[model samples]
Target: MAGTLQFDLVSPERRLASVVASEVQIPGADGDLTAMEGHAPTITTLRPGVLKVVSTEGAKSYVVTGGFAEISATSVSVLAERAVPVEELNATLMDQLIADASEATAVAVDKDAADKAMADLVAMRAAAGF
Candidate 1:
């Protein structure tokens, strides 16, 4: 792995991925963060969004909702609450979720729930190129 970074994605249910790649893009709470082989050692909270993994092989996208990311000199480890491939995402379901979350927000019951729903919607939209 001379020029590549080792990346792993784990969830409560299972270990989703382990890859050696040249770059990785994560959806951090603040924004998107890209990592390479010599990235500084750091830890950050992942927002509900898509994690893009890129390499000479190809590119893969995963929807990750809430997680912690650890970046080091040689590796990046992500422990996610939930994760699924972009292709499997259901837009209709997400649209319904957005509507329900908006209703919740309007009622002022759970703002956090609204935020998470918005994040998920944003991630899905981005993943779908819309």
Candidate 2:
């Protein structure tokens, strides 16, 4: 743990990942950023994209819709609106997500909200390589 940092990824439903990692790549709202053990303290909003975690166990990836991340010298914590392990995602799931997003967009109360939802889904699809 000498060169590693504690990283936690939490969705509204549960904690997705909590482990010591050498590096974490987050899809920040403004852009993507990587955090290491000695990184400076910072906070950022997330966009729809993939999050990469690198540890002794090797690398794992998750797809996040939106969230906020708090970074410190010793840890990085993410509170995600929606997060799913990339390995668990499949074409069927992606199609379902897209359909759901389309429905939500169609029934959205406002244009801005609909746009955001659609954009998030689109990003998710692209990230999933579909």
- For all candidates, the clash counts are 0, 0
Per-residue alpha-carbon lDDT of model 2 for 1-130, expressed as tens digits? 5689999999988889999999999988767899998899999987666889999889999877667999999999999878889888988877776676577567656667567656766777776687
TM-score of 2: 0.77
Winning model by lDDT: 2
**Candidate 2 runs further than 4 Å off:** 96-130
- Give lDDT tens digits, candidate 1, residues 33-100: 99998899989987666799986668988877667999998999999877777776687755654555
Q: Clashing pairs in model 2?
A: none
- What does candidate 1 score on TM? 0.75
Give Cα-based local distance difference scores for all models.
0.77, 0.84
What are the models' TM-scores?
Answer: 0.75, 0.77
